[model samples]
Target: MRIVLWSTAIVVLVVLVGVVYEQVGRYRAARDFPAPGKMVDIGGRKIQLDCRGSGSPTVVFEAGLSVDGSLSWSAVQSKVAAHTRACSYSRAGLMWSDASDAPYSARQVAQDLHEALTRAGEHGPFVLVGQSLGGLYATSFTKYFGAEVAGLVLVDPSHPDQVARVAAFMTETRSLRSRIAVWLAWSGLLRAAAPSLLPQAPNQTARDSQAVHAFAPKSMVTQLVESDATDASLAEAGAFRNLGNRPLVVLTSMAPYTEAELRGMKITPEQGKQVQAIWEKLHEDMATWSSRSTHRLLPNAGHDIQFDDPAAVIDAVMSVVETVRADRDNGSH
Candidate 1:
């Protein structure tokens, strides 16, 4: 019994040490790599917002499920900034942003974004560029504050009905893997394996990689918490139908997984095709949300279309920007 107690105590001590070490590393990463954006206090919390260029209709970039946030749009933001005002912000609990006590619902996040922009003196009628989960938040913004949005560019956005539609197809193995990933993150094991968890280069820059590694735990937790309320958020968004005459551009990625990825996901070719078909169908449905909406497919791009083919994203934003300008000009006449 004494030996058993000693073994357990040692194990606990090791875990505690690992956690502390990981946290210290995270702190160092944050300290060493300073945020490029200004820290604006939206109430109690500070959000990192980076804006550039000058124009009437500001373009705001919203990131996906990942923690990189503004960094995710670094390339595209610079290009867009060349033409007009382009802004990218980190959501609460993301890199350089204060943690939030409020529920991570899409509407609440959208509200936070609105407050952050207002505090930063970035005005609208704004063009919203949202990818993956950010697309949902942008939709919430449109529904809640339609007057503020001039246009929307959704890049491989997540569908509200996706969970229900794919529940049967989802395997327990995937859930188990996800749970293991969360556990690894919480225990600081993921930070130890940061290199593997955060691949550099095409996926991210050196600075972005470090930030992702340091804040991955918080980011993962935020994603799961937000995911819990997706159903309710979707229900609320569904209520806001017919987005008036707002111009909407939906970019859908129809890229297929490589053989290695297919093997990892254990998805057969037929199953993959079915999934793609469903995804495209949902994109088509999303396009119908606005009378002036266009849906385009990126055959060679993946879910991160902005990252894969940023020029396409830039073109989409520019198209919307031009349309908005034209509309404004015509309205005055």
Candidate 2:
């Protein structure tokens, strides 16, 4: 009995040590890397906004759900910055940004972004680039501050109806997955193995990847709140109508899913086709939101068109910027 207790204690001690080591690693990574850009205060909390290049109108990039906003756009931003002033920012509770209060609804998230840009002195009229879930927030921003927006680019954006539609399809499976992910993240197990779990670039060294992974965990509290608020966020964003003929470019990816992805997401080929049909329809509707809108589909790219083919995104953004600038130059818009 005593031997068993001693063994159990040893195992517990090892596990506890591992947890502490991971927590410390994460803390150190965040402290050492520092925010690439200055943290602008949005009320009590702070948001990190990384801006590059010079020339207007300023272009702002918003990331997909649960992604490192600034890092995700590192490659694209650098390229776009060469031609025009481009900025990418972490929403509250993401990356180097501090956590904000509850109810991260679409409207609130948009407000947070507007406030961040204003506080950072990033003057507009601005061109906005949004990816995946970032699409909702981007649209909401335009709705609230339409006059400030000059152009829009959406990269394989998530339709506001997606969460509800997908939820109805795989509620239980998604709920289970979300629970497991959140629990693991909260327990620090995810952070402990983050180096392996996080994405690595072809040119990035292992240490660079580790540093990025260490600081990228989305806090479970924030994740849970965001998940719970999804429907409301969609509803709020859906209320907005018309884009005032803003120059809009929607880039879509038509990459076929691999067997692994299909199985992992619990989607069959038929369901995938159905989803794609709905997705394309939504994109078509979004194009109609503006008279000066175009939708392009890339057969080879995946959902992350920015990463899969940064050139495509860059081209689309530059096109929109040029159009907007021309309008401004001619005093037409």
Candidate 3:
């Protein structure tokens, strides 16, 4: 019996080692992906930034949770840049940036972005293009620094209402708290298991390949993994849901993949399809919640609509850019 117990212990140790090894492998092999551009020091973090092109109302790209970073914008960045100033940046702790800071919140993230823009010499009258989690940041900009924003883009972003919606799944807020505890614990274990990985690249790459890959070019995947921006972005999901208006262009997907996005959440694909149907009804309700907003439904897109359909994203982006230009010309007058 003692021998059997010893063998079991040995087996457990071996299994643990394997898990550690696999995670480390993910960290190292992740290097095979993209690398971030130059770093812009923002507060204590060195944020990665890519700025190109020249025109009025600089177009800025904000990637969502675990995004393709510069890659996500790759499809539309240069095109917009050709007519204006285009910028793409990686938030702290994601890929190219360091992971020295503690966990960050939405306000903290927006501030970091603001500082990064300042340090990078990126002025306002900004046209913000953000995807998924990045959408939260973009919207938060509306909540925090609404005047500075010229235009906004929300690419199938996380809705705070979803959190409240998911609340029905549990017995009460207590269970929700418990689930949060379990989730944090599990994420902590995973992070502890993969120290060698660059700050936030691995997760971002997976997000693009899995859900948001529709429009993300293969190159942007590199910066997404190495940049630590994903964590900061997720931390601010709450603030975005509370966002007011500053001219937002929300691009939603037609194809429902709630089963895929909510593979973890209690939501289902059918339910997501229902939401898509509601968003499609925007033409009917535009006078209400979305006044200055222009809603475009992509035809062959999935949850990551911007990617599944680049044209749709390009259309939204161009629309925002045009508004930015119109605002600029109007300002001159």
Candidate 3 TM-score, true structure as reference = 0.67
Model 2, C-alpha of 155: deviation from truth (Å): 1.0
What is the alpha-carbon lDDT for the whole of candidate 3? 0.59
Ranking by TM-score: 1, 2, 3
RMSD of each candidate relative to the true structure: 2.4, 2.5, 7.4
Backbone clash count, each prediction separately: 0, 0, 21
Candidate 1 TM-score to native: 0.91
* Model 2 segments more than 4 A misplaced: 1-4, 163-178, 184-186, 201-208, 219-221
TM-scores across all candidates? 0.91, 0.90, 0.67
Please provide the root mean square deviation of candidate 2 (C-alpha atoms, Å).
2.5
Question: With candidate 1 superimposed using the best TM-score fit, by how many Å does residue 94's alpha carbon deviate from the native?
Answer: 1.7
lDDT of 1 by residue, 1-333 (tens): 999999999999988988887788777877886777699999988998999999868999988877676888976898899989999998888777888998667778888899999999999989999998788788889888888898999999987887676665544333666657776665777667667765663545677777777777766666666656667867766666566778989999998966755675567877777878988999899899888999999999988888788889999999999999999999931
Q: Mark the regions of model 3 whose C-alpha exceeds 4 Å error after superposition.
A: 1-34, 67-70, 100-103, 165-246, 258-272, 278-291
The numbered model that scores best in TM-score is 1
Please tell me which model should have the higher TM-score, number 1 or number 3.
1
Q: Candidate 2 — which pairs collide? A: none
